[model samples]
Target: MIKPKHNYTGKPTAYLDHNILNYFLRHPETSAFEKIFEEQQVVYSDETLREIKRSKGKENDFLNKLKKLNAMHFKIFVDENHQSTNDAIISDADPFEQYARLCEQLHIIDKIYTATNNTLRKFHGDKSLPSIEELDQQQSSDFIMILEELMQKKSNTDTLTSEQLTKLNNYISRTLQHQKTIQELSTKMMLNYQRDDNASMINTYRAKVGIGPLELNNVKGPKIIEKIWSLHKDLDGYKGRNFSIEDFLGINYIPSNLNGCIPTSSKIISAYNVLNVIGYFNDSDLKLNRRFTSATSDANHVALASFADTLYSSDIGMIKKGRAIYEFLDVRTKIITINVIDNRPL
Candidate 1:
């Protein structure tokens, strides 16, 4: 329970990653965090919750800390007219309650998935290739209904523990196996992204971008990024993805509408991943788990964290990648990388 000495009406909003939050609660230099946190209005998003679930036994502690710190719940959504809401960042949220609702929704989805699988087996003899889009088109497994409810969460006033708020996710997930395609449902998906022996990833990338091959030691920094964005260049984007950094870089404006918001988030995530794949700054543990799942979640953190006034993290790789992405996108959020000064308990 620490408070700032100065009166403040418009404290800067800070989005804290798990490492920074854990540093505050556990590091011997905990008082430093209290002072800094008190001056900034901290917030949490589903990404924060997603990361906390990995702590296993410590989930309650983080949730309690977030609640005690009065961290707002942050989410963005488009409206009926496809316009995003301004009140996306909610101040009165309880992290504990939100976690429970999220968990319950997942559990319900697990159960519903079993039922859906059985139904699929009965009709298609367990050998059918199912696509989520088809189910939505046919309105099977309540896909359409759940999608409607998902979009209606802004007006949802029911207690989260109640049937309406949480089950919507269950219906949606059980409907689609967490929105999986045949690639995930039917087979063990392999990430065979490493190029052939003659063509290394770095060399392959350079060739695509029209740069001559060089040792891994060469090709880096802001200039390479600029070269990737140049229209005259062939590999103007990551492996020639049909869009270059030119498509998103230099966009300084934060979108108020979701039509603008989703693309912006996606661009940030793509740029963050590009840095990792290119090995521009492979500086922390975040890069060790480079699978689609873990990397996507971490990249998403960078995307969501951009909306905050400041993003605080102890992950050096994330800090480096996020800084590069934000600078290129012209996002104004400040990035702070903290390390443990005193590992001893307070």
Candidate 2:
């Protein structure tokens, strides 16, 4: 394999996304060069660093790992000021913008190799920097790409077969299974909330995932507010039966899209219509409490057994909502349709 002469004087920096660096640090095979890369100028934002430092003390170990790299190899700078302004500049309004801003700041200092996919465009948005897409099309992906490229540097070297590459990718994916599972489950919860037009849960989920919600003006008709108020009035703990449209907006509640995409929401609305066919939700908190209470693993099983009797007493609306969801997914497919109600709040 052809190796570049160590004499090259170009400013080549290493940019690490907080999460990706964490992944590498935890992986024994990839982290073999932890000492070598420590001396390199490592790029990361102050916000990310602070978050890592405050939330995960393990980051101190990663920092120490960086300290072992040769003197001229790594530089760490905290990015506090630029991130906030950069967030203000972006219209799309996802929290990822903060990382994009960090990339922009890093590019000003040197030619850095960044580990983030989303911020590549932001870094290359200026005429001076080559767009990531342009660079990839002309050359190859960076960092990992550089490693793979180096493996094929020899004139007669055999390239990895498709099957070999696939196996490697699968291995990497499986190795990262725990993180992926949490992410997927979080996505499922967000998708469920979005379908239900549960504005509160939507904001909660977005915040949980480190993304910001785009400002949207769509509102559910007054009928929804009236129904919710009337139901709340009947519920014992409901503080007030009267709320302004502003109250809903204050909660960042957006109209639930009742389209075909969210079958869970469809099941919920369908169940509610059926419940009105029966004599449910005539009282106040009775409907709200019965549906929205938390359940233990034991309670969930018991709830399933006596669901018929429990249906009219517990949070009917919430149970129906959750049931609609449970049905659409059909994890426990034997559930009676009557026991189901969309549990998520709009």
Local distance difference test, each candidate = 0.56, 0.31
Q: In terms of lDDT, which candidate is strongest?
A: 1
Give the per-residue lDDT digits (tens) of candidate 2, residues 1-346.
1222343232333333333345445654654334434443433333343334433557555554434432122112112210111011101122244334544554422222232211222221222334434544333233344434333442234675565555445433432342234233333433443423323432343344332212111213334434433443333322353644333222212122222122222233333322222223211221232211121111232222221111211344334433433333342322222221242112
Candidate 1's C-alpha runs over 4 A off are: 1-9, 81-87, 107-224, 227-243, 247-262, 282-292, 341-346
> What's the distance in Å from true for residue 205, model 1?
6.2
Specify the highest-TM-score model's number: 1
lDDT of 1: 0.56
TM-score of 2: 0.20
Q: Residues 1-346, candidate 1, lDDT per residue (tens digit)? A: 1122443346788888877777656753447676678888898887788778867788988888888788887765434443334224445568888887778676545344443343222122122323333433343445444555554763365544444434445444543543344223222211121233423334344455554323222445564456434523353543454543554342322222324443567568656654554445543333122233355566778888877789988776678678767776677889987766557322
Off by over 4 Å in 2: 1-10, 32-40, 69-346
Candidate no. 1 TM-score: 0.59
| TM-scores, all models, native as reference | 0.59, 0.20
